[model samples]
Target: MSRVLKPNANNLETGTTTVGMVARDAVVLATDRRVTAGYYIAHRRGRKIWRIDDHVAATMSGGVADVQKILEALTLQAMDYKIRTGLPVPVKTLANYASVAMFSSRPYIFIAHMILGGVTEQEGPVLYTIDWYGSVTEERRFASTGSGSPTAFGVLEDGYRDGMSLEDAIKLGIRAVRAAMMHDPASGEGVDVITITPKEGFKEIDTSKYL
Candidate 1:
């Protein structure tokens, strides 16, 4: 568990805390809004989560520019696929695309860790964690990334339950991020949470009450 929690050199350099959870009928992606450079705080309102499709979203924890470029490419590809096939991209398919993009880059691979979460008529709710090495793991319950992930994972693993309600899941996500903030200097300045559901698609919730 200590080994899993240790941040790679890249994660330590980039600095962030992002977590994703699979709920009964929804997927929640939450992250702190702070961006850092060494011991310096770069941005207080940085965005780590993005909506890629109607029901798919991604959270990042690495080189901001590199992650943004990859996510932008993904958004374009998803949009193109929907235009041509009249169907949303499969959750796993999107995850693989990200993996391939990183792996294909070889020695100069993209420096990013990502959590992709979404919902669909075929797969219900789903989540995947993609590391800088292009490794993709389909998370059955929850996944956390970045410098503060160790603390976040502790809270997530202890509190998460199968088939939890969406509201309960969101609160848990917030709690995990908050817990990470307490211990991880890189993570703080409030949190942003977004939920993906088959019924409502991608929706950002006002997390002020929870924060």
Candidate 2:
């Protein structure tokens, strides 16, 4: 990571959702957008989730600027990794490498947390959250983080089901973020939702429908 993750810095607060589903042959991931700056709305269409490669996408919640930086850095590194290895790294492996890079660059900084989701060329689909210190681990169904994670998780627990459809995923994502917006001062108002279907690739959903 080129930039440091500073835990104490209070620049921006955010909420994000990263969902991973394993179908018969593909994977899907989705994320939400909502950022709060102090007592005001910062960005309504913050694209917290992104496609860094054809088969990989990520959702982030942390220092907005820092997370953006990490995304750029990761994109470059991912391209390099693909070029050098001629293979697609598993989502877990890529995320673990990112964690190591972040901590090694600045151990004192705790500025970013992220969920990476993708399907390996051989291992099916995967989802994992990388913490401020760069610890990465797998999540079975879905994962969320940031200021509104707790509230959002409440909705996730109630609605998530195995092998849920793309429609269900979107519904649950909106409901979770909507509920979070109600209580989490740092979340809500405007929403940016994105869904990635393995073969079709990433699509930034119409914000009007989600909000």
Q: What's each prediction's TM-score?
A: 0.93, 0.81
The reply for model 2, stretches above 4 Å from the true place, is 1-32, 85-87, 207-211
Worst 10 residues of 2 by lDDT: 1-10
Give per-residue CA lDDT, model 2, range 32-151, as digits (tens). 555555555666766667677777787777767767777787788778878999976566667877888778866365577887877665766677787766678788888877777778
lDDT of 1 at 48: 90
Which regions in candidate 1 have their CA more than 4 angstroms from the true location?
1-13
Backbone steric clashes in candidate 2, count: 4
lDDT of 1: 0.87
Tens-digit per-residue lDDT, 62-86, candidate 1: 8777788789988998998899999
Tell me each candidate's RMSD, in Å, in order. 3.7, 4.0
